[model samples]
Target: MDASIGRTAREQLTGRYVLSLVAFLALVYGVTQDIETVFAITLGLAFVETISILRDTPTVDSRWVGVGLGAFITIASLAWFAWELTTAAGTGGPVWFPALTALIGVWFIFDARADFADGTDSYAPDDMDASEMMLVLNHGHLVVEELRQGPKTVPELADACDLTESRVREALDVATDDGMVYPVDGGPIDDVERYALDESKVGGVAFVRSNGKRILRRIARPFRR
Candidate 1:
C-alpha cells in the first residue's frame, strides 16, 4: 500500500517538473519567432499541456478549459498579428513587435487563470489536523511539556489542559508517536483512582481521531529531513 502511494506521488512530482520545463522552453522559443504565429501555437500548446498535467484529471471541465484557452491564445494572437501587419505596412512601424508584445500579455493571463484553477497545491482539511487547534496549541508542544514534567496519567494531563481525559490521551498519543513521550513501564500505567481513564490504553482517542493523511504525514516527516 505504501509502495503504491509512493509511486503515485513520485509520478505526480515528475509530471509537474516535466510540464514546467516544457512550458519554459516553449515560451522561450515563442519569443524568437519572426511571424509570431509559431509563437501562438507553441504558447497555447504549452499552456494546455502544462495545465492538464497540473490538474491530473480528465474531467469535462478540465478538457474544456484546456481547449478554450489554447484556442483563445492562438486566435487572438493571429488576429492581432494580421492587424499589426496591415498597420505596419501602411505606417512603416515594427511588424510582429506589437503582436509579440501582446502575446506576452495573453500568456500571462492564461497562466494566471490556470494557476487559479489548478487545485494542485490547494489546502484541504486533511492537510491539517481537525483536533490540532483544540488540543495542541502549537502542534502539541504544550502537551509534550506537560508530559515531560512527570508521568502524569491521562487524567492528570487532561485536567491540566482543562480538557476531557480522552482529549489529554489524544494529545499524549500524538506526543508519543512524535517521539516526545514514551510509556514509562513499557506501557500505560494504571491510575484510575486519581485520574478517570481506561488505564490500559493511553492514546486510544488520539489514534482514533487521526485520519490516514495525518498518519502518513507523520511517517514522511522524519524522512524529509
Candidate 2:
C-alpha cells in the first residue's frame, strides 16, 4: 500500500466517475423527450456529486470539480430549456422556466471559471517547489483562500486542506505570526481568527479583494525601496 500509488488510483477512479456521470447525463437528455425528467436527473446527480466531492477523503479534487460539473450541467439545462421554448413557442410551456434556467447557467459559468482559476494550485504538497511550499506551509496562502470568507475551526481547516489538526495548527500559527489571520471579533471558541485579505501593493491584492474579503495590509519585502 504505497501512498502515492493509492492516490494515483483514487485520482483515476474519480476521473472515471466524473466522465461516466457526464456521459450518462448526456445520453439521458438525448434519448428522453421530457424536460422535467432531464432537469430532475441533472439536479439529483449534481447534488450527489457535490456531496461526494465534499465527503471525499484526502487526495481528491473535491468541491472544485463538483463546481465545474455543476456549472456544465446548469448551462446544459438552460440550453435545453431555451430550445424547448423556442421550438414550441410560448404556448408550449412557461417562458420563466427557461429564463430562470438561463440565469442559473450564467451564474454557474461564472462559478466554474472562478473555481478552475482557483484550483490551478491544487497539486499535492510534495509536488510543490519552494515558493508554493512556503504558501502551503509558512504563509497559509491556500488556507487563507479557503478561510478568507470567515473564521474556521481546526477541524474545518483540516477538512478543507485534507490535513490533520496538528498540521493545520502549525500552518495557522505561521499565518498568525506573519499577521495574515487573527481572532475575529466574534468567531469560534478557539480564539478563531479570520484570514485577512492581503491588501499589499502586490498585484494580487486586487484579485484577492475581487473574490471578497477584508483587504490585508502589505508585508513589505526588504528588496522594495
Candidate 3:
C-alpha cells in the first residue's frame, strides 16, 4: 500500500452518525411532543454537518469555523437547559435531555472533526504510517469508531457499521494492518477475532493533536516574523 496520503481529506461522515440522528429525532419527539423543537435540533445538527464537511479535514488548514460553531451551539443549548431548570414551569425536563444530547453530539462531532484533520506528516513517519492510517480512516471509519468504544468481533462490527460481515472483515484487515487495532487475546486476528483499540497509535489521537500543533505553529509563524 502507498504510504503517501492519496486523499487530501479524511472522511468524517459515516453510518453510525446517520443512525444517531434517526435515534435522536425519535427520542426528542418522544420527550417533547413538539415538532418545532425537533426541527430546531435537526437543523442545528445539519449546521454541524455543514461545518464537518468544509472545515474538518486534512485538506483544511486549521480552520475553526465549524468547530467554533459547534462550541457556540453546545454552550447555547446548555444555557437554555440551565434557564429551564430553574423555572418551576420550565420545559427543562424536556430541554435538559436534548441539551445534554447536544453536548454529547457536539463532542462526538468535534472528536471526529479533529481526527479527520490528522496528517501523518506531523505525528508519525509518514512513509511508514500514512498508508495504514489511510486504510483505516477511508475504509474502516465506522469500524474504528465502534472499536474506540471497546473491542468486538467482525459480526458485531458489521452490525454496528450496517455493513455485511464480509465487508466488516475487509475493513478490519485494514485496521489491523498498521496496528490500529489488535485481537484482545493477542496474536494474528482470525475470523472470529475480537479486536480492541490500540491507544498508542501514532496515526490517530496523537496524529490529530500533532496536526493541531502544526497548524497553530503555521498560524503563529507569520505573527512571529
Candidate 4:
C-alpha cells in the first residue's frame, strides 16, 4: 500500500514490459525482411533512451555527453539510410552499413540499461518541493552512510550512489549545510573533494536514515489515498 514502493515497482515492471515489446517487434520486423521498420524502431528507441538520459542525469556535462553521442549515432544512421535511398542502383551501399548502425543502436540501449540497473535515476531529486527535499536529505543520509564505511572522494560517492559527480555534490551540500557531513583533511592531488560524516551529528547515520524514511512515507501517503 506504500505509494512510493508501488510506484517504483510499477516503473520497473513497465520498463521491462516496454523493452520486451520493443525487442519482440524488432525481431518480427527483422524476420519479415522489413528492414525499414526495424531501422525505424531502433532509431526511435535510441532517441527515447537519449532523452531519458538527458532528463534523468543531474549534471550538464552528462547531459551534453549523452546528447552529443546520441546525436552522432542518429545522424550517422540517417545519413546512411539516405545514401541507401539515393544511390544510383537504388540498393543500399553495403550490408555493413546497417549492421554497424544497428550495433550502435544496441550500444545505446545497453548504456541506458546499465544506467537503470545501477539505480542512477533514483539519485536526482525531481523538484524542490517538500517531498523532493526529503528525498534529497535521504540521498545525503545515504551518502553519509557510505562515508561511514570510509572517507570518499566526490567520484567515489557518485559511483556509490549511481549518480553524477554534480548530483553527489548537491547531496553533499545539503548534508554539509545541515552539519551532517564535513570535508576530510587531506586527499589525492586531483583536487577532488573528500567528505566524511560528522560524528557529532545526533544519532549519526541511523537517525538520518530512519527519519528520512518516515518523512518519505508521510509524503507518499497522499499518493496512496
* CA lDDT for candidate 3: 0.65
The model with the greater TM-score, 1 or 3, is: 3
After superposing candidate 2 on the true structure, give the runs of residues whose Cα lies further than 4 Å from its correct spot. 1-57, 89-91, 116-225
Q: Pairing residues by index, what is the TM-score of model 3?
A: 0.31
| lDDT tens digits, residue span 74-179, model 2 | 7766776767766754346766776677666555445445546656422223445577666556436557777756677777777887877777776777666535
The runs of at least 3 residues in candidate 3 whose Cα sits more than 4 Å from the true structure, single-residue gaps closed, are 1-42, 56-66, 92-225
User: Residues 1-225, candidate 4, lDDT per residue (tens digit)?
Assistant: 245434544554487777896788768786978887787777777665544544444443342354356456766776677667677654646757765775565455444444455544322335687777887777776787888887899988989988788778889887776567888755466565678876767485766875788677644432342
lDDT of 1 by residue, 1-225 (tens): 445435544675587776886676666667865546556666666665545443443232343443455556667666667776666554455657656755654554454354456543221113335565554545355556565456666666667767776666666665555344665542456524322222233355654555455766643432343
Off by over 4 Å in 4: 1-127, 187-191, 202-225
Best by TM-score: 4
Q: Candidate 1: worst 10 consecutive residues by lDDT?
A: 119-128
Tell me the tens digit of each residue's lDDT in model 3 across 105-190: 48634544644455312211134356756654665878888888888977788888888887777777766766777887634655
Better of 2 and 3 by lDDT: 3
**Model 3 lDDT at residue 132:** 59
TM-score of each: 0.29, 0.30, 0.31, 0.33
Which clashing pairs does model 4 show? Answer: none
The number of residue pairs in model 3 that clash at the backbone is 0
lDDT of 3 at 192: 57
Quantify all predictions' global Cα lDDT against the true fold: 0.53, 0.58, 0.65, 0.65
